[model samples]
Target: MPLTAALLVTVPVFLQAPWVRSAPMAAALFTLPLLALALVLERRGQGQWQQLGVLLVGFCGSWLGGCLFWGWFRLHPVMHLPIEAFALPLAVAGLGGRWRLAGAFYLGSLLGTACTDGVMAAAGLMDLWPQVLNAPLSEAPLLLQGAAIQVLHPWPLALVGLTASLLVFVCRRLWTLGGTWRVTAAALGTTLAVDTLFLAAALVAPHLSGLI
Candidate 1:
């Protein structure tokens, strides 16, 4: 379950990120097929496949939210969290039902995104977001690298350390609960890992960071 949840969190980085950039409507529409497959698996599949269906249902929510925001609201960095959280009410309601795993994964991913955005805001990187993203492709990498380097300063580095430590502690606590909480832990932990890698990429190879 943990491995599957982790892959679901990571897959969007490679697949959805670029796809949404060029074809937002197509990316958004793809949710139908994903949800269809998920429903089919939930009805006909057993054991692991059934579990994957539930997770895919959750992924569809996240994927759609991402496509909406990155597609149209990318320039408005401040709207990122709100747009990505469009399914918050539904996810919360699903928590006590059979789709608890889906809720867990979505909530975990949302929490990670919140924390990342909070850290970025605190580190003063939020102000640079539009500039870096809107810059010409050839120039964006340098801007992104500069933004990544800014985090190396003492204050931003301290903020990053504190946030990372807090998230790790939360993940460890969630891990102790077992069951669906483990799904939450894995999703959150994988998101943190991905954010770390993205930062590294922004520093060393910003063009590959997928933000552009």
Candidate 2:
């Protein structure tokens, strides 16, 4: 299924995170252990360690979801949206019934991609001379797309991280319930806005300079 490839792609990307920049081959090997941890966290239940388990699981699941969506669907250029945008956010809303939490998951995945891309870009990974469009050429178009994401609609990496954090935090604090559908509606609305913005920006980005 998509989850497998998502996990596969997530490994190297995390290892190649702009911050680390390990050799491509080595990065894959490095993330093998994390892969196992990801499985454990994903399967973890709501017991004493539930919070921590899901926290780690959310990160991995979101990351894997994005990678799998992008690789499986072949949504290139701007893979941030189509990749993991709808599915995972919807999952958060469905599973936790918390808009803030779901929103956070959406943004956190974007943020993860953003951080990976940003670190690489800063380290000269994106500086490679190759562009499908006319803008600044980068090595991985996915990374470029990650860099291009925004906080409000298009959903930047920081936004994802913040949203996920808020989701986890608020749920724990308030422990509210009975608003599942409302939260679901809000989550869907948020996804729609992000999709609209991404499409609009994509069309306009070609004509503009580095504004994208």
Clashes per model (N, Cα, C within 3 A) = 0, 13
Best by TM-score: 1
Best by lDDT: 1
Task: For candidate 1, list the clashing residue pairs, or say none.
Answer: none
lDDT string for model 1 (61-160, tens) is 8999999988899889899999889989989998989888889999999999999999999999998989877888888888989999999999999999
Q: Which ten residues in a row have the lowest lDDT in candidate 2?
A: 1-10
List model 2 lDDT by residue over 142-185, tens digit each: 43453454232333444445554654454334224423323323
Report the error of model 1 at residue 51, Å: 1.1
Runs of candidate 2 with Cα error greater than 4 angstroms are 1-14, 18-48, 65-75, 94-103, 111-212
lDDT (C-alpha, whole model) for all candidates: 0.91, 0.40
Candidate 1 yields a Cα-based lDDT of 0.91
